[model samples]
Target: MYHDYTEPTWSAQQLLLIALLLVPAVGALLVALLPATRSRLVAVSFAAVTFVLSVLPALIRPADFGWFAYTPLDSAPVPPWIDLDLPWVPALGLEFHLGVDGVSYPLIVLTGLLTLLCCAYTPAKGLAALLLVLEVGVLGTFLALDLILFFLFFEVVLLPMYAVIAGWGGPNRRAAARKFVLYTLAGSVLLLLGVLLVVTKAGTGDLVLLAASPPLDRTTQYTAFALLAVAFAVKAPLWPLHTWLPDAHTEAPTVGSVILAGVLLKMGTYGLIRVGLSVAPDGAAWASPVLGVLAVVAIIAGALICLRQTELKRLIAYSSVGHMGFVLLGIATLSVAGIQAALLGNVAHGLITGLLFFLAGTIKDRAGTGSLNQLSGLRETAPRLAALLGFAAIASLGLPGLAGFWGEAFAVIAAVDRGGPFWTTLAAVAAVGGALTAAYFLRLLRRVTHGPATPEVRSVRPAITATEWLAWSPLILLTLAVGIAPALVLSDTALPLATLLGIQP
Candidate 1:
């Protein structure tokens, strides 16, 4: 092993990037050791640093024609912004590889932003440290280039999120946490097995190598893809697997719900595109129809569930299932347009749903409830809050001028343009689901914000806190910005996605 292994070299930039990755974990440790009173300040300070590091790569990496394109060299599919390649286990051919590209850069920035916002919005409680820890996992998952490394980062997200829910959540937090653990654990088992299968067959755990020169044969790819699908779907929480999401979101504290929807759930769909499809195209193509069908069902089913929900938080939670459905449908198409749509949808949902959760939490805190039935006449009692909520709802419903529209519109276009009987049918069904989404949101708005104020609402003053405004403004502005100029995201993603899927560049 020693004879074959060579010590890896790192440049200053690579070392600095690695340091940035370690900052959150190091900060978490420091925060954990500090007095609880000072933890929030320290966490936020560290989060700000981490956020700067996250955005640095985009500036450092040159882009041509608005797309972050890289010529593959030494068999690397796309030149990672800062590839840290070093042998970890020579016998197994595993390396301590980390990097980021167009596909992951946006999400890394998102993780940083959301983490900072979470810290800012909440009191200087013990929760800030945990959020930082979760950030480490989320960012690492986006950056990891080794399959084993990716899996480790992916699992790191579980404990902190569970703690957040169980420790800070509402009445049903315990049960929700348990359900979340059970589902994710079950999914992880399958995912772990899949990783093993791929690595064993490929004889290496490096994601870059696996994609550049697929080592697994078609049969093995199919088996691994199937296993990975179950795991990712559970996290994506598609339709039947999505039961845990509503409970977790409804019970979780505001920041918990925001991060869960904004950053955590995207992990699953992102994994599908990055690992599932890139590593196993044949399997993905074979499974696309099934995936597409479930996606459409999730869209329709999630909307249908929301329509009947009496609780505001739970309804919004259910709405995520529907919103994520569009992301999944886009991935199933396996076309460049489809994957780009998925990526755009991911960011849009993060902005839209995160804002919704933040607002919902504010309403609950102010009026002492999250029940739509009791949340009447917000427009009359709290016009500003109602306006914000209304705008977020419209964005979520895929209004023409909102960020949500591009994702849904492109997903349908990808499906229809794929031009098979099955895909065309998926597009039609999803179009129907889009209408249902509008219906539920309209119903939600009419019930919660437009009606006459109830006695309870009248008693409580729904003043928007400075913290709420501070935390929500970025999300609100981004939703509008992305809506007006989707090219901000799409341009960067196009070449990379096409490269990943073997589409024409």
Candidate 2:
């Protein structure tokens, strides 16, 4: 179990949490009501404020108590840095609970930053408002401490994303949007069932309480974890459930793809840690082998498939399946090192993959085609773009000093730490998958960045735009920063993960 830092009275911390959700919510409305001409400025302003506010929570010190302060007899597992709880639908056993800690703070900031960048980059008239609305859902999902509230926030992202894709996406927008919705809705149904089961059985929707003392029996815990895991896997789009992602990325607009790949997919991995494992440790233990196996499968399958992909966006989309497989693998280890690596992997994937989509979108837009065969010799025309793409690809392939390396490398280390034949085999196979990851990315760079300039490449603009630099620079810098110093994401995570997993500090 963890400790709680709940306060009886409202404070500046509480106000900031409320504002994180409200600013986006209010901004969505204002963007709709205000002139479209001013929408970009207004949306960016709100997103910027929210991003700034999200960072403030991290500066608020965690309670002075250390992880070693607790004993095995104690029941405090994961503690919030700051939390606010109020009665909401008491009859339904729900509360208006909100909180943030080491685990959630990084993701909240990532969501805010990506939303701000997307808003700044997109010029579509009404899309800015929709992006804000999506921000509200994602930010709320990361903030909510109530299970029911989390579900509501999670659902909130569905429609706005559908609208973004269907309204502003490419030629087959409607079809891609339909598939995305259908697959996720199916996952949501399972997610809802799991939430209702846990709440009804435990008689409370407060996640902190549930994490501290899971009330379900072994059987019920197994059932709940299974439902939640499968539901999140759909969002994580693990392996076979990942088919929708390629099409969605292939058709959605650039900003839409950025948000989708950047922060939205994180909801699944976050839920697995916060809800599935925290609320049902026995079940997580029971299912780790299966989870580990499947994650390995996803890693191998996604890489092999990417090797065969022809379209640029579709290949990047498939790569997510493999990257997220590392995350899921880390979670399956259920060690402090594994979970910490999972969190770092989550943030790194967001930065690197988000940049990849941005560059791919720009290339597709300028070249008038996304086909790898028709796109070549990018360095001859767009040297800067090619260089950035090369950096992103290398980072995605887990280059030693970059953001992507630590999470994946540590995930394997954590598995080795687990020290069993089964996990050892999974680690070996996953290592092979890593090698395959490098192969496909190098193949991608060769096809898209090297070789002689094609007709499409010759016609493309060589200069990078101010908006592109504005949006991509931060990701570039952060990817390098996090890669060089992973402690940026991992510093606050140890205590929470240790307590949550019952591992001694």
Candidate 3:
């Protein structure tokens, strides 16, 4: 929110936010125009170039590095302390208002980072376009201030993701994509309805205005909450709503899985915070218990499923359910620590789960399958790969010095801080989820990392290529950086977190 000029200077939001759309738009066209024979080159170049371009905004207008204390005792500004507005649709009372605050910035940076990483690791020629398109939608969703614009970005995820999964996924992909779409679509319909209801009741859909002055009666709020929550919940893939994930993750190609885990899943959690909490505080408070119970179920059930899965991709996919359960639990707490944990968890899952999928894909490439029973003794032929996998696993299992720990640890600690029978018990369940996470990772390790080589395991290949390392190293380094210095992240998030969570210090 630090801008030298109020109106004279070119806005970073103007340059950076608009660039997100333009790059992908142009990149997609360029990719399509390239000779088919250089299709691989085109895909790689488009991704690589687009990634470099993504950093321009950050380099040009570096994010302000400061913390917003959450207590009432400290003075902190509510975010977008600097704001930008451009008229796009006047009838709707909407403008292209873009600005950075504690909440949006990290999510924005994470989306940009992962999109670039995705472009790096993403290989499918036909599907890369959709991924780029998905990036546009996600980036827009995070930056958008209009309620309808936000919803558009939210639903933009539907088609491109469906196309990616259906076009590039495994044998059963069509069905998996269909199931994924049907659920999300039903949810989107409800989301649209809630949007209309809010706009009708509140007289405006501008998120800034809505957040400034949310309307609707308590009854209407709860009704809208249920509808919108169901819609976002489908995305959150919470408990019963999560049936589509394992199949989607299992069937999706590596990069597809990566984006799915890395960014798409966070959309659900993001909506919970952005739309659910921000627009429907009363409803959110009312439904917190429902979210809380479902989170507990997901934590316990997802962990148990991970323990049983024999396929590496499926295991990681299920682990997402558990990881995201903590995200929901954090949101449910309705406290700054809880919300911060959820935000932290969002970034952590993107790093850790993305790495796990990437490594799993590498193992599958060398070994010809992702089935654990068919592979063993990765240490013998691919010791370095084994080490990377170990690193990702233990980190995901919530090892203290790693990125994954904070999300889960903070969620549980925040829940404990909330100190209710429900919160305390769910905290205990999430802790068990944590322990079970460690158990399964350890189990996967025992099964795949060491001991005498089975025929399938012994056939493991050499170290990852330079390209692969480049694709993965950022995520690896980020995991360590965030884990070691979460304050760096937390500092960036403080104001937005305080504003959204209604904390003022």
Candidate 4:
């Protein structure tokens, strides 16, 4: 039943996903073609339109929704909601397909929401066009179900992002962009090889089919999974894989950092859950313990480093390492609760950490330096900004009232339930990691938000913009809403989660 829902059958809403891809592409191209000297309003408006138009499919009733896109040439018409197919090439047994069900719906929505936010917050006309094109790439990556196609969309996300950071970033932009691309390129190469191995082994590259009847023998699967895992692990920035991130975050322009932390990183964990767990459960089970230990190390190590950091952007960057550690913990558990917790963490981290970067960028944009020692009286000078930072920070510390809490709460609980010698030993370590997170963030809050006025205040005050608040409030609101009701995500995702975990439908 879950496989039936996800196959490449073209439904009406599924076609909307295609439109979601095309509309932004067209609009962004137009923006790019426009003269750079023109008012940036045109670029911003075009970007905004994509966000407004995205609601078309999201509003569809569950009953009306099915997944796929088709063309008249060799396939059926793309449905308004779904698309499915078993393609030709019997010799190879491969199918070209695409679809989305409830599990992927949140990411689809998040990509749309963050793209819109990116559109709203972007300042440069040239860059606005690039950002819109980037949004299309992201949306495509989320919706694609074909392995080869998915790889293409995944690669598409990188170029625009590379351009955005290098073209518009601070003084260190070139180095950051290079580092970001090098890491992602290395990951993408591994993903490509993994995709090739699966196709070569199983004679099909359709994600739906692969998930339904996975490719590769146990040895081959283990090898293929290592390639895929390391590829995604880099993107997930798990512990040692995370070094590229802090530099990227510190140097990236506001919107670049926003999208990077918000949507791009989740792509990795999403792939791990969707493709890795579903298609290579045995390998995933094999890798689970190692992932657990690393999770604890990342949580603890990231927190420890943050305690030593004086740079505000770098501190927030390290906090991401800690927060994402919870995400890893959830993935490592190999339980439904753990998977769900990882998903929860994905969404929460996007909201909370992305918000932190946004507000941190605002402060840095004002104060001339992101160094914590140079900052003081932020609350007095830019109270709204201080407030946004506080909300994002406390949430990062997993305060119960916000979105960040549930992923950790669920992960720790799941770890305990997945108990035994190693799991329990490591989970206890993760629990201690939690305390470290709280300790450092609280210290950061005091030093940044609760200090006497300094020369920075006069500078920070004048730069506060209404536009920043407008862009930030929605994320903060979602953080609060999801904290109160995580079921919105978990419920919709249950069937897909069950399928991935090999639970009976």
User: Largest TM-score belongs to which candidate?
Assistant: 2
For model 1, the stretches where C-alpha displacement exceeds 4 angstroms are: 1-10, 62-76
Total residue pair clashes for candidate 4? 27
Residues forming the 10-long window of minimal summed lDDT in candidate 3: 68-77
lDDT for each residue of candidate 2 in 364-456, tens digit (9 for 90 to 100): 999999999999999999999999999999999999999999999999888888898999999999999999999999999999999999999
Regions of candidate 3 where Cα sits further than 4 Å from its true position? 1-12, 37-77
lDDT of 1 by residue, 1-505 (tens): 0012222333755775687678988888888899888888888888889988887876655332235444443333555555678888787777788887778888888889999899888774667888988998998889888899889999999999999999999998999999999999999999999988998888888777666667778999899999999999999878879999989999999999999999999999989888997778889988999999999999999989998999999999999999999999999999998888999999999999999999899888888988888889888888999899999999999998789999999999999998979899999999999999999999999998887898767765758778788899999999999999987777567656765776655
Name the lDDT value of residue 66 in candidate 3.
Answer: 36
Cα displacement (angstroms), candidate 4, residue 75, comes to: 27
Ranking by TM-score: 2, 1, 3, 4
Q: How well does each candidate superpose onto the true structure, as a TM-score?
A: 0.95, 0.96, 0.93, 0.91
How much is the lDDT of residue 449 in candidate 3? 85
lDDT of each residue in 18-58, candidate 4, tens digit only:
66777778778777777766525665665566565555544
Q: What are the lDDT scores of the predictions, listed in order? A: 0.86, 0.90, 0.79, 0.77
Q: Can you rank all candidates by lDDT, best first?
A: 2, 1, 3, 4
Against the true structure, what is every candidate's RMSD? 3.3, 2.1, 2.8, 4.8
